[model samples]
Target: MDAFICAGMMIIGRGISRGCIGARTTCLPGWAGVASSRRRNRHRVESSARRPFGKRLERFGVEQGMALIKDEAVVLRRLDFSESSQVLAVFTRAHGQQRVIAKGVKRATRQRASVGIDLLERGDIVFSQRPGGEERLSPLTEWRQLDHYPHLRADLARYYAGLYAGEAVAMLTEAHDPHVGLFDGLRKYLADLSSDEPGLLLARFLWLLLTEIGLQPELSVCTSCRRLVTEDRVLYFSSRSGGAICRDCEPASIEKFQLSVGATKITRGGPTDARGVRAALTMLDYHITEILGRPLRAARSMHATVVKSVSGGG
Candidate 1:
C-alpha cells in the first residue's frame, strides 16, 4: 500500500510540473498553482508563470545550461529593459553584433570596475550564453571598459560622426558574424575623429566600410562598358549603374553626379582636395543610402561639418 501511494504521488507531482511548464493556471482538481513566497503579492509570479513556456523560460533565464563567452566589445546602444536592468547592443571583436542583458547595472549599490556601458565605449566583457534558450539574449556577467572616448562627447560634430559609425556597424553588419578587421578599423576611426582633417578621415572610413562589405564602387572602370576609367577627363557617377560611367555609356535618363578629374583621382588614393573629399562624400552618401534604403541621420551633420571646415579654412 505504501509503494502504491508513493507511485501515485510521483505521478501527480510530475503532472503539476508539466502544468507549470506549460504555463497553465490550474492543473486538474487537487493541484495548487506554484507560488513565490518571497513576494507579498503572489499574483505576480502566478501571472508570470501563466505565460507561454518559451517566454517564461526567457524571463527566468532557465535553459539547458550556460556557456561562457568572453570577448572584447564596443558598446553600440543600450535600452532600458526593466527598472534595474538594461539591454545592450554591442559589437564584439570576436562575436560581431549582439544583444546582452545587463542585470542590476542601473542599481546604485551595484559594483563597478571600469565597465562603462555607454554609447561608443569599448569594453572587455564576460557573458553567459544559454543553450536552447528563447530570444537568444545572453546575460552579461562582467565588463571592463577599455576606452571612454571623452573627446567624442565633448564635441557635437565629432560625437555625431561617432554615432554614425556605430550605427552603420550595428545596421550593416550581420549579428554574430565576426569581423575583427571591421571592429578594429572602427576603433581606429573613432580614435582619429579628433584629427585636423576629420571630414577627410570620415570619407575615407566610409569608403573603407563599403569595401569591407564588398560593395566597393568601381572607380577604376566604367560599370556599363567595363572600360578603364582613365583620369584624363571628367567622370560621371551613377548610383543606378553602381559606379563611374563614360560619356558614351552614361544614361541621359538617369541622373548622375559629375566628378572632376581631381575627385576621380582621389578615389584612387591621390592627394586630398576639399572638392575631392566633398565629392567622395556625396558619392558614398548616395551609394550607402541606396544600399540601406534610407538616408543616414548623420549626413546633415556631416554636410554641416564640411561647410564649417571650408569656411574655417577660408
Candidate 2:
C-alpha cells in the first residue's frame, strides 16, 4: 500500500509539473529568444541544476564559465521583461557588445542598475554563464553602478540622439567586433551633441559612422574620374551608383539635390571649414538617406523640435 501511494504520487506530480511548471519556461531566453524549442531547452537547463542532479555539462572553451567574470561596461539599452528582472544590452570596452540579464530588477529598482542601466552609466559588472538556465544570455550574477555621464541625460535631443547612435551601433556592429575609433567617436559625439549645435554634431557623427564603416563618399574628387569637384552646374546623388556623380556619370536613377559652391567646398570638418558643417551634414544626409531608404528619425525630430534649423553649421 505504501509503495502504491508513493508511485501514484510520483506519477501525479510529474503530470502536474509537466502541465504547469513546463509552460512558462518553454525555452531559455538567449540571443533574442523567440522560439518554443529554445525555451524548452532553457527549461531543462534550469530544472536539472540541483543537488541531486548528476549530469555534467560539456566543458567547452566557453564552458569553464570564464565568461562569467567581473567586467567593466557601458550601458547601451534596457528592456523590461514580462515577469521579473530587466534585459540589458551593454557595450564593454574590454569584451565588446553583450547581453546581460539583470534578474530581480522589475519590482524594485536594482542597485546594480545604478552602475550601467541607463545612458552613459558605466561601472564594474558581475556576469556569469550557468550550465543550465531558463533564460538566454545568462542571468547577470551581480552588478553595481560605477559612474554616469549626467550630460547624456540632461538634454532631450542629445539623449535621443545617443539612443539613435546606440541603435545604429547595435544594428550594424557584429557581436565582439571592436573598433576603438567608433567607440571614441560615439563617446565624444554623445558628450558633445548636448552642448554643441545639433546640425554640426549630427553631421560629424554621420561622417564618422560612414568613414568607420568604409561607406563614406568619395568627395575628395570626382567619384568617377577623380577630377576635382569644381563649381559644377548641378550635382546628382544615386544610392545604386554611390556618392556625387559627375555630369557624365549621372544615371537616370540618380536624382539631383542642389549643392551650393559653398556647400561643395566642404571636404572635411575640423578648424578650417567649421562654418560649413551644416552644409556638409545636409550633403551627408542626402547620401545616407538615399542609401538607407529612410531619413534618420533623430534628424527629422531635431528639425521639428528646434522650431528653426538656422542655416549655417552643425
Candidate 3:
C-alpha cells in the first residue's frame, strides 16, 4: 500500500512539473509543489540562455547594442599602430569626426603592397562601434579610396595648405558633431587648391570654418563696447574680447592687434585683392592661434611657401 501511494505522488509531481495541472485542479501539498515551481524557473533560465545575446538584452528592455555605420570621410590624421594596422582621425560628412583603428590595412600579402592610409585622403568608410562608446576608438572595417587630390601632392604649397586645413579641422571640430556645410566647403577648398592661389583659398576656407563653428569674431562692431565700427576708425582686433575693437575700447583689451581697413573689410565679406587677402589670412590665423593657445606647426611653412610663390611670380 505504501509503495502504491509513493508511485501515485511521483506521477502527480511530474504532471505538475509539465504544467498539466490547470487552475481548476488542486496543487500537490507542501514540498512537491515547491520542487515543481523551482524546476519551472530553472527550465526558463536555461531557455533564456539559449537565445541570442541581442534578444536576451531585449527581454530586459535594453535596445542598444553594437552597430555598424557607413559614411564618406576625409583622413585628417594617421598614426601607425602596428606592422599591419593604423589609427586614423577621419572627418566624416554626416557623422562628424571619428577616431578609428584600421586593422591589417598595412599588412602585406601576395596580392598588393601595404601602402597604408595617408592624410588628406577622401574615401568611403565602414566602421563598427557600440552604443555609448563614442569616447572610445571605433574599429574601421572597410575603406575605399575615392579622391587622392593628386594636385595637392604635386605642389608643395598645396600640400602644406591641405595639411593646415586638416590640422584645423581636427583641432576645432568636436567628435561626433556633424558639420555638413563645413565638410562641403573643405572638399571644395581641396579641389580648388591646385588651380586657385593657396593663400586666398586658405583664407576663405578658414573664414568658412570659423563661421560654421561660431568662432568667427565680430567684424562690424566693437566686441568690448558694442559700438559701431566704421572703415576709417583706428580698428583693433582682440580675440579675447571676441572681435574688432574701437580705439577707446582697445585700451581696455589686454590682447589686441591693430587691423588695416582693407583687411577689416575683407574679413567682413568685402572685395578681396591679393594684398588684402594675405592680410586677411594673417589676421584670421592670428585669431586661430590665439584660440588654440599656440601656433599651428604648418602655418609658418605654408606662409613661407606662399610668399616664395608670390615673389617668384613678381
The C-alpha local distance difference test score for the whole of candidate 2 amounts to: 0.52
RMSD (CA, Å), candidate 1 to true, equals 12.7
Write candidate 2's Cα lDDT for 187-292 as tens digits.
6776676577655566667677777777777665656665666654565544455566666666544465655444555445632244455456567656766666
Worst 10 residues of 2 by lDDT: 1-10
Q: Cα RMSD for candidate 2? A: 12.8
TM-score of each: 0.72, 0.63, 0.76
Task: Please list the C-alpha lDDT of all candidates, in the order they appear.
Answer: 0.65, 0.52, 0.73
lDDT at residue 303 of model 3 (Cα atoms): 77
**Which one wins by lDDT: 1 or 3?**
3
Looking at model 1, how many pairs of residues clash?
Answer: 0
Q: Candidate 3, which segments miss by more than 4 Å at Cα?
A: 1-64, 268-271, 307-314
Backbone clash total, candidate 2: 11
The order by descending lDDT is 3, 1, 2
Model 1 agreement with the true structure over 187-225: per-residue lDDT tens digits: 898899766466676777777777788887788888888
Best by TM-score: 3
lDDT of 3 by residue, 131-230 (tens): 9888988867557677878898899988988998889999999999999999999999999997978877887888899999999988888887888888
